[model samples]
Target: MYRDGAYVSEHVRPTTHAQIQPNGVDLTLDAIFEPLEPGRITRNDTEIGKRQRVASAELDRKVPETYYLEPGGYVVRYDEVVEIPEGHVGFVYPRSSLMRNGCMLDTAVWDAGYEGRGEGLLEVHHDIELERGARIAQLVFAEADHEGTYEGTYQGENYETPRD
Candidate 1:
């Protein structure tokens, strides 16, 4: 069975009340990066290419920072940290607003026991301006059976300290 948004909220940090949906919790964009070189993935080894963080324009002190992107691909990091509980797998889906704006967010399965401020590949079909902390994706959890919890290299990624 899939967990409701209220249940999912317990696993995410720094979430506003507006970010909670009926079925999932929304995630906001923290930063964007552009790949500088090609990455590699082998049967036993993998290496991500170097990337440069995209700079956002600060219009005014009262306004939020905004990223003006052309039609292209970029990597986006979520602002909120998430902890996937045991016996449940987390799935992230792009918010409808993104699709309506001609963009798509692709993410990998968040295995059980995974904890991090994760990232996703953003494909923009049209020029778009994204504001920092704008809701971009929604995370939902579904029950699943597994032999053990995740302990891969990506576990606890992008976190300065473990959540209590």
Candidate 2:
């Protein structure tokens, strides 16, 4: 139920662009993601470089903010908590502009009633260079009808990315 300005339709011509675009859209990131020691930029530690296709649990460990992403790379930061209603599915895809720029958006299939901070994964396909805080993807929410929901269902159970 996406509407332009007031009501965004499921599929409609975009008011912002020449072609149709989805409603409730987000922009490129303003800040870049980089590995920092003690969350502070030392300005000398250049060991932290580009990371690609690797899923690391840096979020599990508390580190201070330091450097940002380099060229030919993409980074992710979590936005608000988008709760998929009970009996619905959601998808996240790379923006067309980002695709043209050779940036890859790492997406995930969100199940019904999924909770927690919605962070993203950044990836690069070719050896192209990019900056920090770049537009990567757009999340499209869809509604579904599940009969006898929660009736002996394994879904609906919520768990964090890392559970201790």
Candidate 3:
């Protein structure tokens, strides 16, 4: 069975009441990056290619920065850190607003026990401007049986210690 939004919120950090949905929590955009080289995958190893951070523009100092993206592919990092609890698998889906605007986000299955501020591939089919911290995706969890928790290179990625 799928978990409710309130229950899923317990596993995400830096979240607000507004981000909690009926079925999941919304994830905001933290940053964007463009791939500069090709990545490689093999039976024994994998390597992510070089990427450059896409810069966002701020028209007014008081306003949030915005990215003027043309139709293309980019990598978007989520602002919140998530921890998938045991016996649950996490899935990140693009919000409908993105699709209405001609954009799509592709993500991988988040295995049980995965923890990180994860990333997703954003494919833009039309020109669009995205503001930093804009709601871009929803994270939901479903109950599942697993023999073990995830322990991979991406564990604890982009995690920072909280300040006192």
State the C-alpha lDDT per candidate: 0.92, 0.45, 0.92
Off by over 4 Å in 1: 58-62, 161-164
What does candidate 3 score on TM? 0.94
lDDT of 2 at 1: 45
* Cα RMSD for predicted model 1: 2.7
- lDDT winner between candidates 1 and 2: 1
Q: TM-scores of the models, in the given order?
A: 0.94, 0.46, 0.94
Cα deviation of 7, candidate 2, in Å? 6.8
Deviation of model 1 at 113, angstroms: 0.2
What would the per-residue lDDT of candidate 1 be over residues 122-153, giving only the tens digit for each residue?
99999998988999999999999988998998
Per-model clash counts, in order, read: 0, 15, 0
Q: What is the lDDT of candidate 3?
A: 0.92
Residue ranges of candidate 2 with Cα displaced over 4 Å: 1-24, 27-75, 126-134, 146-164
For all predictions, the C-alpha RMSD in Å is 2.7, 12.8, 2.3
